[model samples]
Target: MNTKLKAMVVDDHPIHQTIIKQYLANKGVNATTFGNVTEALRSLQGNTYNIIFCDLQMPGKDGIDMMLLLNKHGYSGSVVFVSAMDDTIISSLTCMCRPFTFNVIGKLAKPYFEDDIDKLIACVCDKHQSKASFQKQIEVDEREFLVALAEGRVKNYYQPIVDTKSGVLVGYEALARWMHPIYGLLLPYVFLPIVEKCGLSPELFDTVFSNAIQDIKLHGIKHSISLNVAQDNLEDALFSDRFLARCSENNIDPKTFTIEITERESYSSNVNLYKNLLKLRLNGVSVSIDDFGTGSSSLEKLSQLPFNELKIDRSFIQGITTEQKDKNIVRSICGLAKSLNISIVAEGVEDEETFSLLEEYGINLAQGYFIDKPMPLEAITVLNKEKKYV
Candidate 1:
């Protein structure tokens, strides 16, 4: 017999509790119900769960608090947020709480039917398997020489952002990964911060840009290639000139490649940074404000710089369907971009609903797991050969 899917369902309402219990029971899940955070924590003390289906708004402690509690207990189960609150707010909350969160499997809107619950459970199961495999891969990677390999372990993964309505691939983002001989592949989180701490960020940036440029030329990719540059690298005259010269020497049009600076640094205290940016822009390189709206000075930077694109961060885009406030924020950004004639790309479209919502809201460009995950440059070459996106 298949083991029942174990879950903890938390909500203050008795009817909602009954509904979830009946729903889970129909799905062959063994669910424990809790009307409050204290009871939920108490239940957690005695047993482990495979999933937690929690309401966003409860009487006290709330959904966010419950997430923190789960993290504090080291409960590595999946979290499925099921709430009536706006999806955007829930999505935003999820992002805010992600650093301490363990395993968030799904986000289901409230007033959900049995079909929704079943689909969510199925999704969670699929995600659980992928996460397990991914974590195992990371573990094997942890045993390898990530530190030593960081020196020569430059890799680039191309993730496509297509026009939703036209389905045309307009651009690709360059993602970094570290491949170890023994441990397989180490993700950016494993070695990127370490590289920065070890004072190799500039070198790493060189490798990423060089490989990205080469890939663009090798695969005959004509669309814009987005590469992230560290704040420290932006101030280096030698680094910037070398980058420009590489593009010139390779005949790779600087206009087709965008150098992205995170929103945090785009609003830097250094007044001269704008001059550096201006110089690059004058040479055909486009600048982009990455992860817009996470920090202050978004309006200031947007007005001050000649940025060609504004990327709405995934945190805000993840749940715009349900959250009215989130929708408004996205709408505001889209409207602002339209007024400014700046191209907008919504990052992190993980589901069909989110993708559709962005398109409905007039966001043409999108990149995330729903379209594709970041993969090795070799895979991207295959995609190029396949001509999946023209």
Candidate 2:
């Protein structure tokens, strides 16, 4: 227990506030209690707390409102939702807060046990420690992206997507990587946001597409290649035509290409994107809904789109071995995809046990480090020739 640790409890109920305060006191945490969000906001002005235990259903401004306010004010501390809300609402709130760059410690339902408080305290301490150890990442800009593109530093790395049962390579996913002179190697997270912000997704796509075609031809790998398609690309009327032209120029069949639409992109009611996706499918290109279960309107998108594949998000897949809830969720997704005649690909399967479980669940395909890390073009070519997993 760190005596220097500080936390705030924001709850209207006297009993709930007392319980949280006592729990914090037991853990040697300096705790502040606020009965309303207004006073909490005032407290935040003059003080900094490492963790905040917030209640959802309050008199005036609700917990969601407070969280949004906290995000707006750039609160970086961990937040624990202590509420009586149903599991679905709590889970949704948890998901909502995570993307705002806050460490969501977890949730405690009303009538929580002593163990729940203990777990919450442990989670906060762990997250705080992890956050403390995080290094400030280098921010990338549009100029750097253009320079990288011109210098031929923007490249594609291939990660093998395999059949769950036989472990045979059925396809490969093209992951973007940057060979930065200073940084050595950088993943998509470093520069993708800048590309998206600058509306240069097409340039990035072109680089990956060109590299993928070259890799396939060089290796003579007769399998599908999946590339992430940004929402901007989908919205562009000429995107499909441009992509087909590239395939034709490279002597690559459109049937051997798959476009993966990520859940992170908000494609809500974008009719043009839907039509373009449909057009691609009509032209023998496969479309997959990537990161399947994490999005807000997953079911709606599935209902509206002509996606032939559903990729269970890594977040759920990573938890399948340890969490029953994750297993159930994945099982449900498998059932739903099967009913729709959609192929299922489990992402982030890092162990034989997980791979076996996915196979049992009838997952059609899988891609993760357990199969192979994203390899360079030469390495992919060698692996294709050998027909072996390294």
Candidate 3:
């Protein structure tokens, strides 16, 4: 509410205009009224509004017309369409906004009440955030990355993974982050490939492995912890011996750890690769195939390897609530994993609706932003105390 909302009301009817303008005025919103999309676009030329209250049924350049050109005119603010537009047409039009990189924040029919307008206003308020700090550019070179890693700037941040049915915390996936002193937080995709290309993947894994052990012991993290392994870590002949040696030194149960192998990275047919995987399994560490539906070799990889878990990628999980195709894909994956006697996890579950559908789909575990964002071990309060997420 403190964002200082500015709105553009596009409507042709004089009475509706007066009513909407009055409502906005009451709410302390600075609103500019336009009788048509043509006038609205003219106002948007060099000016920007936080949101636009657009009418659907207009003479030329209706709601659809305005939306199609909004991004082209450099208007990145959110939009709310007003009219008695059919739900079917609305669904179809919603797809168009994605390409324009703007969101249809809300919809209202004709003859709506003040409460409905207030609801849309609530949506706008919910989307606002505190003033953003200046973001430094993320560009990085190899030597700088190596220096950062050497300084122990690349560390593990854990995100919670919960049991879907009980909504109880079951585990956490240890993800890597570059806590660069100057560059801030740099994600894996930025530096991981560089590390792998420079044949430093095992070194990076050593850092993560050491950090996970230290965090679990220091934080008293009792839940399962999953760590992602690079392809090189598997290909190395001594990875298994070194890994088991560390686990023995720490005196932690191997069952407490899960190794996540992305679908694309497991193509190596090294004897050491197969040996390491088998040795880890024999020692009681669970192995999971991450990003289930994303790879071309998903089924073949599952068949070849002795995987204990299958993780449905977020790309598919996020769409199940709205896309029938995604729902069907997840259902098939769940059935396949069940048949294989394997547990399933749906990651990237950001909302309650998605999580509920995943639970209904028989997902054994779920993880993503909705459950929790990855953070330092100290920030995960449930690690120290039992907590229910649902």
Give each prediction's root-mean-square deviation over alpha carbons.
3.4, 5.3, 5.1
Q: lDDT at 148 for candidate 3?
A: 77
List runs of model 3 lying over 4 Å from the truth. Answer: 1-131, 196-199, 264-268, 381-383
* CA lDDT of each prediction against the hidden true structure: 0.78, 0.85, 0.83
Q: Quick one: ranking by TM-score, best first? A: 1, 3, 2
Which runs of model 1 end up more than 4 angstroms from their true locations? 1-4, 12-15, 55-65, 80-96, 103-112, 134-151, 217-219, 264-266, 351-360
Strongest candidate by lDDT: 2
lDDT digits (tens) for residues 233-315 of candidate 1: 77765655777788889987778888888886534655446666787888888788899988788999888877988899886
Off by over 4 Å in 2: 1-5, 11-39, 57-65, 95-101, 110-137, 158-170, 182-190, 217-224, 231-256, 263-284, 291-306, 312-336, 347-362, 367-390
* Weakest ten-residue segment in model 3 by summed lDDT: 128-137
lDDT of 3 by residue, 162-221 (tens): 999888889989988998767788889889779878988787888888889998788688
**Comparing candidate 1 with candidate 3, which one achieves the higher lDDT?**
3
Worst 10 residues of 2 by lDDT: 381-390
Candidate 3 lDDT for residue 228: 89
TM-score of each: 0.85, 0.70, 0.70
